[model samples]
Target: MSTPAAAAVSSADGVAWDLADLYAGPADPQLDADIARAGERATEFRNRYEGRVAELDAPAMRDALAELEDLSQLADRPLIFAHLLHAADSSDPANGALVARTAEANSQVRAGLLFFELEWLALPDDHTEPIITDPAAGRFAHFLRKGLAFRPHVLDRPVEEALEQKSNTGSRAFKRLFDEITSGLECDVELPSGPQRLNESATLALLHDHDREVRRAAARALTVTLRSNSKVLTYIFNVLLQDHNVDDQLRSRGHPMQARNLANEISQESVDALIDACAGANGMVQRYYRLKTRLLGLEKLYDYDRYAPLEQQDGRWSWDRCRQMVTDSYAAFDPRAGEVVEMFFEHSWIDAELRNGKRGGAFSAGGPADAHPYILCNYTDRARDVMTVAHELGHGIHQYLARDVGYLQSHTPLTMAETASVFGEMIVFYRLLEGSRDAGERLSLLAGKIEDSFATVFRQIVLTQFERAAHAARRSEGELSTERIGELWMDANAPMHGDVVELTPDYESWWSYIPHFIHTPFYTYAYSFGHLLVLALYATYRRQGPDFVPGYLEMLRRGGSASPRDLVAPLGVDLDDPRLWQRGLALIGDMIDEAEALAAGRD
Candidate 1:
């Protein structure tokens, strides 16, 4: 049942990541050894520092931070391995069990360490400030300073430990089940070759098919499957929404995203500004789709048609080609980044094959600082697939470079995390667009870039808005029915498309399949924040050319060592200015302007 596109992309079928660096497999004795050792260390840590955080001097605090970092790595190693295994194939009962066991273990270690943070939070600002500023504290200064932001939300040690322990069976269980159900879904699509059962990722990729009928069938197939599973999925969302609401209440957050914003090291006003800027430019979305409609010679565009190729001869690149293209793009930008991208392939660090139970979407996991990061993606040989590689490699490069910052401080907040990834995509995209052989190819490439940006910027806002609505509705109206949730999804999405695209009834159930709502509430806005920030950063790079390279890499190297504002200020970008966000949006507008001119044969 493999299509020509599928057959052509078979090079990726052999590209599974080698996780030996973490452990040989589930049976590896080192996994248990590490877990047990971490538990013992956690106990010793509690015995030594549980009630002593406030009394520790700068040097002692520095030593304590180093011990905690090592403890975190030991705990994270097995948990991350289990997560990667489960993401690869959740259908395996052992994989699911491993996930559960490691999660419980992680929670136990975190619970035992709860008193350290609570006692630290108890210190007066005068007592903590000098210690935070001490050079002896080293990179732990930012780590300690960041902890103070959560002081207002810290609960009693017993209460904190109780909540952490209970979550494994509560919200965590729901999230695992949601992943299992969604990843195992099979959509029956009636292709010209007859009915074919496709996994969630393959089925979703069909929306970009050159054939309208195939796209229609794929859309219907997805809706049918989602509707069949809507009850459990809707129940999952409701439970998670309530769980989030309870957490919000316990943490004393005023709004649904307040905690998320705080965790992102950003303020509510800044998120609002990013949302407002994207929402204001929604006209650009409608305009681009209208242009697509004309280009496709269709009387009306639908949700499915939004991603259709403008021509039949869509480019397809094999795995090797994609590897070369991405590395070349990065190398052209900076030789050092290019070397990191090459290392991902030379070493078995990327899992980019199509497997039955593999998770949909893509992510770069910073597995263990002692080892290295890993990338998970489904590469289908489409042109966009090339950009996907570039995107994830961007994250891989960022994660690889940030390892020197240590485990606790290496990972950036969600808002700034997408910077390197989006910047990587931009470079690859411009490379492809510049090399286009004709006006038609240029138009297609330009349109694809614009849509990708829209997906990251405008569509993410719609998702965040839908999350806000669902959260508010759950608070006010109790558990929402599937139909009620679908209405909210449509309301949030319809504004972006305006009258340009027709959203059929089948599109209603589509929201149920998104993992973000169930796994991480309000996580979508980070995409918007990162995309806009990168657009502005990419602009700075274009202006300064080679000079921007060192500062940008250094920013990634610093990782979460400082606030996001401090991290990017050296690059000449301000996180606070709404005008900066609009500048990014203006770049998207310029893209549309170029696409329109190309379509009119003016290029």
Candidate 2:
């Protein structure tokens, strides 16, 4: 089987990311010097342009922006490295200290620049509009729009600074507390061999275990552990909710999700349309589960069975084979994409090995605007691992193309950021399907891809629905008991999964572990939106051939410079049309139909 050790490092054409590019080690002298320099630059900027932004000419403003961007780019390395290292080994005290120090320094630097935008906002439209109209400033239109959107939300300078200063002690402190408590919990579960202690990563790994009893035990242990700490989790929820409510009230936000939508730069209608479409596809997900039940020879699938491997006894891919497979798949899609994926393999940009204290899951960190993006994954050399490599490499290439836009516009909003990743997966999956000669192998691949779509689209919708209900219920009825929160979760998920899957009673506590609900409320819908959007985009690509790449690259190149509507409009895709989402859902339904047909033919 694909073992943790095999994924420790990547090798392609003898190149690697050389994280040493950021720092020789955590204690490198350059890191310390960079931190000191960032502080000095922040103070220098404050003294030079804090209150005089309105008086500056276009050239002078551009110079000031360049300086700010340079400082931000310098700070990026230390901050990203610190956080990445900490995530890889949260129990390491040294890394933890590094992360804390970096955060404090970065916060100070950010506080110094707060007045730059605020002062610009204070300017008359005549002064601001001309600057915004200038070709040089055109790239910053979205950034400017984002600042203006928060004009009403901006408090007076003193109030804003005070709030920022107290943030670490308030909401931030509770966040850390929640993380520590959750990460440190060790659940004892009975395995086939014997009882064992389950850590955060191990608990998730159980969901893929072949033995049904092992998966069930793991699920039970997780629920029981979470249940034991529900009160503390509830308090964390209360503090974060109240914190947001107070801020929203002070800022006069129309609704709880208004600020989030503003930050995402997506319209409320767009999100609603996506959610409604996914809810309409609930029947499809249920149908897929029924198919899964018949394949597993079970009367009813359970929650734990949702992620069970399609072929329980299948051999795992060796790390080398996994890398080759992913790169080959990419080459089949586009030579340019294959080159980007190859760069990641050769450059050691990926840290794919699983280890003790290493963070669970995978993420692509956008590197310095001037540098390459870095990917971290706890790869197990499974098919999913290869797909993840493809997924992250997509983000890397997107970042590479976007860097041409310069620092200010290189960052895409979270809503559209998943586009390249999901599209990459589609490319790889299609390549696999076409190359497979055996019907069984093709059916397995199709099932895997459909399950991934369900996880990203359907699962996220359920989470968003659960968060909406939980937040509203909390506001109207006071703090939710652990039982009440579980009920809300089941309400959202049970119907989506249907009668083919039996949700264990303890699955209610599953809501407590979702970091997105706490970190970014209502953020789950973005995944669904991105998945559907990519499905549509991929379909268009298949029909249009080579013509689609330029349009696809152009969309990524826009970064956060335009609205989602404008970004997709060039390709003749409309985000406002609910039918587009339904179209995406229909594609997934079609795949499920194919899988069922193949299965029936086998019987």
Model 1: colliding residue pairs = none
Checking candidate 2 for backbone clashes, the offending pairs are 15-346, 15-347, 16-347, 16-348, 17-347, 17-348
What is the C-alpha lDDT profile of model 2 across 498-531, one tens digit per residue?
Answer: 7777888888888887777777787888888889
* All candidates: TM-score: 0.98, 0.93
Give candidate 2's root-mean-square deviation (CA, Å): 3.2
**Winning candidate number (lDDT):** 1
Please identify model 1 stretches exceeding 4 Å from their true place: 1-9
